[model samples]
Target: MINYNNFIRALIIKNKDIVTAIVFMAIIAYVLPYYTVGGQGANAPSDGQSVGGGGAGGGGGGAGVTGVPIHVVQRTVFQRPYELLPCTQSVVELKKDLIPTTDFPSLVNETVSKFKVTVLNVYNTPDYKAMLLAEGDEKKVLQDPHFLPASATCGEMILELLPSLVPVTNIYDVANQVVSTYHVKVVDVYNMTDYKAIVILAEPDNAITKDSRFINYNQNNTLSSNYTGSGELDLSSGHIAAPAPVLKEETLPDSIKRTFTTEDLKGNAKSNFSKGVDADIAILDTGIDLNHPDLNVYRNVSFIPGGKTGDDDNGHGTHVAGIAAAKDNGKGVIGAAPGARLWSVKVCDKAGECKVSDMIKGIEYITQHADEIDVVNISVETPLSPALNRAISASVKAGVTYVVAAGNYGHDASTTSPASDPDVMTVSAIADSDGKCGGTGPALKAHNVTDDSFAHFSNFGPSVAIAAPGVDILSTYLKGGYAIDSGTSMAAPSVAGAAALIKAGDPNMSPEGVKKALLGTGSTPLTPCEGGPQGYFTGDPDQYKEPLLFRKLGAK
Candidate 1:
């Protein structure tokens, strides 16, 4: 038997042995370990595959050998502003009430024990991580925090698994330990900088309510030395919840709704519905003006660490905010999902561009609180970063729909970072409305501001998902004004709203399914293009008659 006292001192939290816990303990104690593809490969266990166990974001195992391992998410505690509070070990003991002996085994469960996984929302705060436990094991996770590992601060949440959990030889009955379909991993973490710290349960009630963040490196941005976390594991819960719905422009209140005096089609998206309650579309852009009447009601604005309310120090964030789900509460121009919630995870501020690290933090925030937001519209672009990819993937995994604006350069359709990830619906711009006229823009292919059917000065190419009305768009502005702007930046939120609408209608669609719905439901029959040189169709205003297209044109 593994020495009860001599067990590695690595366990930071202790547990109380109750009936249910005893079951788990017994299971773990008796669960025989066979060779599993722990360190590498995929080959799911043949038997004992369980779901709906009521724990973890993905999957886990009781106590048995399967073909694959039980993946556990390793949490790196970070420097949290919250203080960890001390608690009686009884809180963990109470968890036994929730567990049944049938759920686990006997031998181990009967021992002195009290443990559970950490909670999700309570601990990542300011005063929670400072509390210490009586024995250090009784402290609430809200008070505890995990830091980044020695080798890395960013971690990928591929799989939290133990190889022995999967019994290869016994299940497959094959001499070889590999399975045929073992390559489909739930995640990849060798490059993760987030999960390199310790795990802490945030509350005293039970372990399920913990908040785990990377530990603050004693040295800023540096990692620990002895940590080499297992990051290549993968597991899943099968189905994903669908996205939420957003409000449309037509449905907006008359005061805030922008009615084109002529027929301006330049905007993110358009619909014939009423823009419901002005949703708080958090624009993590430059900043927003709280005083602007047109945007004020819609400007459910807030700031990050160094920013302030009503302070759109930079004009970019304000512009994007107007295009997003601004309040439709009898204001100037109605927003996309006017009534949806908006938050500004300001990655970029007075500096003009958000750092790759900060951007991931913002995404992390959205993922952690996806229930509060309707859509996260990212108008800014980043230089390709793997960490962003993981963040985007995590956001989707967490059920947050990420809509990234395609670049405005008529050069290439796509740029970097969030835009590059297909998981993040990439929204491109199309000159649907004319810059000079209030009516719809001249039906042209695409182009810069010049007379020739020129391309946008930004970037362009195949990375473009679907083009929204990115032209001389008139929407809410900072400090009580409506402005006309042109760029792919302006067109993305339309699709974002569309995503919100889809999500609202069916909150069970996968990220891919949401993308498909938008692309699939788009109005087609419009001519391909007519601006490009020969016949490929350059994006120019001269050939702007038909702007909408659909995804299901020929597959029938």
Candidate 2:
């Protein structure tokens, strides 16, 4: 027609570089929007905005970006346009099997999961950090708020995903980022220690269980970490499926009998022994009877949601509290340390059921008041939880002594948390029916345990720190009355009181120092069952030496 072929060939030859440039621009125009549309492009995050999708425990995103931070990318390769829909819809409901397309550096759903995060901040004054220093005005520092209680949620969980797929710096950072991304309603951010555990309520299969931030994640049953974990609570009060056999409860008789365990421990040896005036003991249990006349409760707080008051709906806590620190009043039975201040940290429900997260929260409360609290008496038996252990380790590092029960399971105490932890003192039980040593006490035949002998129901092993009167122990009960009960639960508080007594004498003594004093001054090795074995109990093995609790705190 007009020499069109000739003309096209001439043009290509004249501007070959221009032609190549145009083709390259066309390819870039098509592929550029795919990576830049909703991710790291014009719709990028602003200052103070969190970048990341998925839930708070950091379970979101399909493929990770190499150079870019996982949190900042709006959309990733192969992600869908699910963010366009309302966040209220569940991930399961929105897309059956679709993966997140945008590599968003922001969270998807703000209110993802319920988690209680303990945020610690400095109690600094404008001029100087007085609260941090041990100065003259100690009372002022103790009164200052060291923790800002906060509740947070990440977005909805990504169903059936691997936890290790997403990487995080630490559990604390994950918690803080969740708070920021969700615009969590927090009064203030804590700046107390370098790190504070923020326990998450992740399921066993949740991605958080395998997160990189955790120190130890017990895959056997529960999930725990240096910063987060998940598990339910089992107080092990000789009830339910616990190893401690269930025992019958008895009402108080007309004549309130004197506590024989107190006398046996030499708690009543001196008049001053009845008054552990300088020490404070926190009871983490099913709560204490606030109105009990026989106990001197200093303060009470409950971590059970919707259960505000720290009242003992269950009698176990009340009984345990009385054994530790009943009043020296003439009406009620005297206790091991009658004047020790009691702080009721209720973590169990009315049925005595609890969650490990709640227990961690209680421990957080103790950590916040670590300066004022001297000892913590934990009478519960639970599986080894890294999260719970981490919290206790932090509290112990803050200078709080922890005393836990060896459990009533009649098995090795090495299987339980807190009891298994060597940092804290683990107390086993002794059936001192007459409250005297030498195995001379009466036998509790119905329970098949002899008097003044190693308790048949007490859990033992190398972890058992000490033994005390546990079987048939009578102490304070619910509704301001008295009752008789039995378990290692009773034995643990006895040692707790003894610890309080030691603290009363040496207020600045470390936890290790207190344990040494108890072990060094213990009286009488626990007698084995009659004709059972030289070192072993009736049904339990005692390859290791176990000392009985004795009061010899240098005239205190």
Candidate 3:
């Protein structure tokens, strides 16, 4: 009825709108796969349970179909005071009132729920406040008021931060990381229960920043790095180019036999022949001269990695070893226990600088070989370190007798390590100038002096266990020579050698029993130091005067 072309045009225009809508819908379907849905990214979880859902190629929620699981990384954190405690105090009591109870969970909840912190470790000491390591955002934790409580019970707080991704396997790794990341060198590593605590030294022009991992961890750990006071392992001897003539009639040179290695001290005389025959002693000091003519060094081990050989280069260890176990060969000086075997554990370098970590490594080695070694001598001194003290205590419990120097600072030995350790025998220095036998013998007159009382430089305190000849001491030196030196370093070996003698006399003697024997048999009521610097003594002069070493083997 109507014009056919016009009717067709009207129908096409009417359907054009619908056709355009269909084309737009098609374009959206193609592009929809390239974008996200519900404003969630491709990696975002759908409902906080699963990840990678409702995305371009993501699978829809299904009971049978699996999805990628979400993962949360864990970090290890540490917290301590910004400064070390002036003296040892119980860390448990320091924080006892902060938490509901002493159990680990209670402490964890207080930190976690309140500040979103994760407590990974709590290192407590009976002598000092506790240190903690936790995982959390350092900024948030520090900002939280509860993070460092205002209460006195909370004590001072220092934060130590470790990388969440890095895995710390041992102390060496911790030390390396501190050096590489912070540009600070670690001077010592303390072996804790599950962590290796480090003492760091900041580099010049690169001071440790507050943001540094060490500080952000705990400020107290930072205090350990600033402790510069150290005690000395005295060495006053010099090297003699030529060897001394062998004694024709005596098993030991008169210089030594008249003092520490005398028959009065149960020291094996020339006729005893048994010397420290079957016993073993380990010396932790500078490297020993393995090629020396007088020493019978059984083993030479170096704790200083990438350094010189264990052979004595500075002549300190050589001198110490000669004092402890120089052979009975007539050509040179004799040791207190000449027949006993010697293990030279070099923890120091030629300049006599020993890192606390190196010394700890040397201690660990002695601990592992405790069954083979009966005596250990440490002629080095450092500030009070609880870690080193624990190591020495452990070694003592393992049946090893430790003889350490009382230090040469002429101060309170209790302020120093090894000397302050109760389990070890701390030896002080006495100058026996006349080589006399009586307790009231003449004062030491050697080195161009009249009075040979306490060496003017010897450290003395309640911690000292015994006294030995340390002034103008003649012993083995470098290049197969003999020299005279003096220090508490010389005094400690005398006691160590005495311990070897005691062990040789009674192989079944316990460490405690040996200590008792040494202390009980010492020659007491000896004349005190006279005509020397007197300010070193902080206590009664009589109390600082330790008993002279004497032999009481096979006596009840």
Every candidate's lDDT: 0.38, 0.52, 0.53
Q: What is residue 354's positional error in candidate 3, in angstroms?
A: 0.8
Off by over 4 Å in 2: 1-270, 273-276, 524-540
Stretches of candidate 1 exceeding 4 Å from the true structure:
1-280, 295-305, 308-311, 327-331, 413-415, 434-455, 524-556
Given candidate 2, what's the lDDT at residue 526? Answer: 51
lDDT for each residue of candidate 2 in 498-518, tens digit (9 for 90 to 100): 888888888899999989888
**Best-fitting candidate, scored by lDDT:** 3
Residue 467, model 2: lDDT of 72
What TM-score, over all chains together, does every model reach? 0.43, 0.51, 0.51
Candidate 3 lDDT score relative to the true structure: 0.53
Q: Which ranges of candidate 3 are over 4 A from the true structure?
A: 1-255, 259-269, 274-276, 438-452, 526-544, 552-556
Count of residue pairs whose backbone atoms collide, per candidate: 153, 25, 33
Query: Between the candidate structures 1 and 3, which one is better when assessed by TM-score?
Result: 3
